[model samples]
Target chain A: MRDGKDDAAPRARRRFLKLAGLGTAASGAALLAGSGAAKAAAPAATEAAKGYRVTDHVRRVYDLARF
Target chain B: MIAPEDQGRAYLYRLLARLLAAAPDAATLGLLRGLGGDGSPVGGDLQGLAGAAATAGPGALEREYHDLFIGVGRGELVPFGSWYLAGFLHEKPLAHLRRDLGTLGLGRTAGTKEPEDHVASLCEAMALLIEGKGDLGAQKAFFERHLEGWAPAFFADLERARAARFYAAVGRLGARLMTLERDGFAFVEGVAA
Candidate 1:
């Protein structure tokens, strides 16, 4: 009851605002790191299918190699 | 030896046309895995060496085609059985093809006269065979006599051609198809075993 006075109300509000600001900053930093990881992932993906063109032929069941 | 039981191989031809017209399967990832997949190889190593030059990557295959068919100088592989069989480009095989064409009611396109032994023509013939478009028995006989012997030689050369990467695959497909057809025909000759 002693601390729950007029000053306590304002202090709690200030703490909540400060915590909200910190949470946003932490989330933004995590998002930026995630975005960087995704960006790095893209080039690696491109290298896997290097120079492979799409196969337009209809699907064939026979394994030509199985001949 | 190609086999009659090995029917409906138009899928192979269709795959080739697509690979040539567009590009190889993305599944393959541009790897030149071996293609002339007969049950056994008669002379695969030498053939692969000779045709390795015609790999269809950039300009190598086209240049090889030019040298083989359209080059200012004579080409290495003639791409025709008649040329190899009769020592000339056009010969009885082609004439017979026309006669058989009449019997089958199949007609040549307007001005496309590279002779019936041309690889494309051979491919077209094989497609027709697979689909039973022509008189199947006569066509089968013609294929056995005319194509069975020399087409393998041509495809072997093509597989190992200097420009043969992509085309090596094509050659492999062709050679494998020839083997299937040859065996199929042989089986019929034997007793449908």
Candidate 2:
């Protein structure tokens, strides 16, 4: 797992994770990718707590989720 | 790597910045030199030291930056995702990450040429995700698959890199975050598994 290679305990574990819901096979992640620098950042200290603006891929995932 | 989904949180950025900047002696150790703070070993370490090579006095730090990050040849750690993950640099991880980005509705800025795997970029992404700046589930997935695996090792090297001084602290901070992320993810997995 740490080596990024597949082994027994971890590999099997990872496989199980995939079999479960966590092993989400990511599709094309390039859709909304943007330069993070220009994206307006919510002021660090602000109380409003604005979001960092997610990509459409995330929205898709959210749509898929039963949660 | 603290669950990239949570990276958008201000706490994450502050932790990262603190990791980058040696937690000034006071906050770190509790020994306040002028204030009589924690007084840990790191507390008094960097005080006598100079600035970061890239942005030192009279642009010394900038010079160091050229030396460290923007040298004509190559920089210290090669802060790219491909380099870190694939070892040879620009391998499947980068392609995978890019694909993930596309699906997520995120786009790379036209101006900055650095690949998506840059540490700053990763951290920025996480920070955005954390503040609910993006979809929590999507951000979490991005962070879990790509970063949680490799970043800790990268930060470990950064801390111990021969040229490390100021960035040594950055390394430590990163190392700590790595621990947090690893354990945190494991905990989450523990539940799902």
True contacts kept of each: 0.01, 0.00
- Interface RMSDs of all predictions? 30.5, 17.6
TM-score of each: 0.52, 0.54
lDDT by residue for model 1 over B2-93, one digit each (tens)?
A: 22122224434333323332333323323223323222232242234224423344345455445544334344555556666776655787
After superposing candidate 2 on the true structure, give the runs of residues whose Cα lies further than 4 Å from its correct spot.
A1-39, A42-67, B1-9, B14-58, B133-139, B190-193
Per-residue C-alpha lDDT of model 2 across residues A4-53, encoded as one tens digit per residue? 34335444533433332121211011111122332343333111111222
- The candidate maximizing TM-score is 2
In model 1, the runs with Cα more than 4 Å from the true position are A1-67, B1-8, B14-60, B134-139, B189-193
Using DockQ as the measure, which candidate wins?
A: 2
Worst 10 residues of 1 chain B by lDDT: B37-46
CAPRI tier of model 2: incorrect
Q: Give the Cα error of residue B124 in candidate 2, in Å.
A: 0.7
Predicted structure 1: lDDT: 0.43
List, residue by residue over A1-67, the lDDT tens digit for candidate 1: 1113354542453244233222222122222111235335322322221112111111110111122
